[model samples]
Target: MANLQLKAIKKSYDNVNVIHGIDLEIKDGEFVVFVGPSGCGKSTLLRMIAGLEEITQGHLLVDGVDMTHQPATERGIAMVFQSYALYPNMTVRGNLSYPLEVSKRPKAEIKQRVELTAQKLHLNELLDRMPRALSGGQRQRVAIGRAIIREPRIFLFDEPLSNLDAELRLEMRIEIAKLHESLGNTMIYVTHDQLEAMTLADRMVVLRQGVIEQVGAPLALYHNPDNMFVAGFIGSPRINFMAADVVATTVGQVQLRIEELAIDSLIMTVQQRLNEGEKVWLGVRPEHFVSADGADCHFSSTLTFAEHLGHTNYLYVDYDQEKTLVIEQRELEKHTNGDSVTFGINAQQSLLFAQSGERIR
Candidate 1:
């Protein structure tokens, strides 16, 4: 079993602290992804798990054993770095065989393990090829094979596909996902790319300034965000926000006056009670808008720009106080610049957030 438990994890540099007390749990054979903006300490936390970074304070328990200050080699963990760290002078077989041979495994055992790993990664044909002769994808596979050959209980990936082009990244994503399925080892991957986090993770840990903002399955965090930062950060086009006020209240609903909308008061159904004239922020996704004639809240805007992405269109419009609004269009007529058009948003789909950025469900 490879279950990991982090107790009040903390890290610092020269007395300047980062990685605020972080507590997390990882079950055996689970795939967890750590994602956040740059400098958020996802990589630092992963390194701590690998025993590469010293923990300032906290207990790192793996399978109920404290391995916090253990040396990396004895931690039963293998890491795949952003750069494919292959030995330039070594062939693929040499790289995969080195780890087992160093552990004093029998020669026959090393050869068997190397051949099996090569077959699993489809690198058998290139086993004799040097790193210099391999493409970006091939080199990365060899790197992963090197880690797999050790049969470690845990795998750590730190932005492993960031250097590859978009197409290569997609291909590698599939390859890594397949590898995880075949291995069933505890895997912790870190990346700033939301798409990667969304697609690859069984659970996602969203962090900010070294503190975890939220953790859950990708869609759970997407549809039911705990705060504004998560709602804005999780989506591709990003969610929209407008300053609003509670004008009145009724049974199971509240009337809101959004400054950006010309409409008087739009009814929003909610489970929480609001004081009359209380200020709040309302948000909706880009694709939540409808034609003005069909919507309760309508707002006119000058079309600043539009993009046609073959199957869909992205509309950027200039709205109140120099704020820009993005509307996603699919199965709708194409729009162009300078067009004065009105759009509508559904009250039920709208999200309310307190001034402090907490979600008000």
Candidate 2:
């Protein structure tokens, strides 16, 4: 296991700066995930850490040793890429033993390690099969097994499950989680899928446009984002945002009027004071909507669409002329499309953001 430190890490192409100065510390045996949309530079940063790309500036320290200029093989790290990257002609046993063979290990040691790694990955029965003869999930397992055979101090997964089917992805997710639990190595995962990050990471580093937006536990970032970008990116079904104008301000609360929802006045607690007429955004997650009788603030809208999952239903209604607001519901009531539905949210469960996209506490 190893702890990693990144100090003012940056990357640029010609005069175009991609990664801004970033400083972070990853604890030993911690499962950290870098999550962001495409073009956000998550992969670039991961490659930099893997010694595949040169650091434009800044330092990378591993286990208290500066390794910014070290070669990939000497970094004691193994990576599982998006593609399986297995040799077509090699059997699983060959694939697993190739690294040891290249390192000139004793034949007996290579045999023992290959069997052990195959057993660990549940690939024993498929050891004699070629990559072309394996399923997608099996191939991925082989890829992981290859990495495991190296007994690396650190593991890097670059969207390793993106190539599998949904069911396979879920299965592989559990497998990876179990592997981490048993191995307890420092692992860094890169993915654009927020749900994957939420499930797998001990902490998530949310990035946007090559800069970090937030870094914290999954639920922490979900419920207590520092900015609108983090708030908007970390949740599924998306959060609802409504435009409002501050109507009044009290000691630790502000009263607002939401014209889009036709709300006359709603009071919400805040840590910051706002001007009487300052524009702010009201943020509410889908699941925060409540029954009308239990609501602090309510509005009515015609249901434009409804998605019925097994345990929950998502209701969508048109808002702000072009935007749609999604409300999560778990009741047994059935409402057809175009039916008027009343949606309510407690003031205490709502969040307030400034027009500049910063959360107002």
Candidate 3:
């Protein structure tokens, strides 16, 4: 196990910059996930950590030793890519043992490590099967087993479950989680799927446009985002943004006038005082909306769409000409398009953001 330190890490292509200056510290044996949308440079950053991509600037330290210029082999890191990358002709055992063989380890040791990896990944029954003969999940297991046999200090995964079906992705996700628990290795995973990141990461690094936006525990980032980008990116169904004008401000409270929903004035406590007449956004999550009965605040709108997923229901309402509000309901409600629906907003749970997308305390 090893800890990593990235200080002013950066990457560029010719004159164009991709990864901006980033500074982060990953603890030993911690599972950290790098997550972002496409073109966010999450994969590029992971490749840099694995020594696959060269760093254009800054220092990378592994366990207090500089490894920025080290070769992949000397970095003591094993990587698993989105593609299986398994040899078509090699059997599972051969694939698992090839790395040790190339390093010229003892024959008995290689055989023993291969067996242990296979057993750990539950690939013991598929040891003799070729990559083509195995199922996709099995192939991924073989790929993981191949990496496990190396017993590197750090493990890097670049969207390893992207190729699998939903069920297989879930299966492999659980398998990977279990593997991390058992081995207690330092792991860095990159993915565009926030659900995967949320489930697998001990802490998540949310990226955007080659910049590190926020890094924290999954729920911390979800519940207490640093800005609008993070608050919008981290949650499912997205957070609702409505225009609100600061009608008044006091020691620890701000009175908001939400003209969009025809609300005259509503008061909520805040960490900082806001200037009166300043325009801000009120953000409410879909799950934060409750039934209108006995609610602190409420709004009425016409339902535009509805999605029922048995355990939970999502109601989409037309907020304005440019936006739609998604509300989550625990109890299933039968509603058709264009029907009038009322939702209760929990003011205490809501968030406020400046016009520039920065969170306002």
Candidate 4:
């Protein structure tokens, strides 16, 4: 296992900068994920670490050795791409041993490595089968096995599960997680899927257009996002944001106007400085909403739609100003398209963001 470090790394195409100076230190054997929307530079950053893309500036170090200018073959890294990229005519054994063979390992060593990788990946029974004969998941396994046979110090996966079906993706995700545990190598995975990053990463780096938005453990980022962008991006069914004007401010709490709702006063603890009459956004997660009366704030609205998902339902409600809010409820009773419903939330769980989208607390 090896630690990877990137210092002031950058990339550009014809002087149009894509990756703005990024610095990170990845501990040995740590599973780090780079997650963000497309065109956010996650993939470009991964490729730079893999030595596939030339660094426009700054340095990259692996195992404490500078490798910024090294060739991909000398980086001691293996990558599994979204496409399996397997050779059509090559058998599974051939595909797995190809890298070792090119490295000029002894014939016996190549055979042994291939056999071991096939066994680890459970591809022993399909060793002689061509790529065309294997299913999508099996082909993906072969791609991974090829990487494993290389005995790389670090592993890089770039959306390796994107091409698979949903069920297959889940199965492969578990398999990859188990593989990491068994191998204990430094692995960096890049994906746009938040759930995958949340479940697979020991730590995650969230990026926005050529910039790092936040870095933290999955639950940390989910519970306490550094800014509004991260707060909205990291969760499923996203957090709801409402426009409000600060009505009152104290050392520990502030009151806000929730529009025309009869119960509009919402008090939230503030960790940052804010004066009265300042406009701010109120953020509340779908699950933080409660149907009972014991809440810090309460509001009534007309239900516009409800989606039943077996155990729970997502209710979309609209107020008079056309602002829509989503609420999650269990055992939802007597709710329809035009029925009025009241939802409440605890003030401590609510998030406040300034006009700049920076979290106030």
Ranking by TM-score: 2, 3, 4, 1
lDDT of 4 at 153: 97
RMSD of 3: 0.9
**Per-residue lDDT of candidate 3, residues 35-79 (tens digit):** 888999999999998899999999999999999999999999999
> Total clashes, candidate 1?
0
Q: For model 4, how does the per-residue alpha-carbon lDDT over 212-281 read when each residue is reduced to its tens digit?
A: 9999999999999989999999999999988888889899888888775665578888877789989988
TM-score list, all predictions: 0.97, 0.99, 0.98, 0.97
Regions of candidate 1 where Cα sits further than 4 Å from its true position: none
RMSD of each: 1.3, 0.8, 0.9, 1.2
Candidate 2 structure quality by residue, lDDT tens digits, 270-350: 888799999999999999999889788899988999998868999999798899899999985777999999988799888
TM-score of 4: 0.97
- Predict model 1's lDDT versus the native: 0.91
lDDT per residue (tens digit) for residues 131-241 in model 1: 999999999999999999999999999999998999999999999999989889999999988889999999999999999999999999998999999999899899988
Q: What TM-score does candidate 3 reach?
A: 0.98
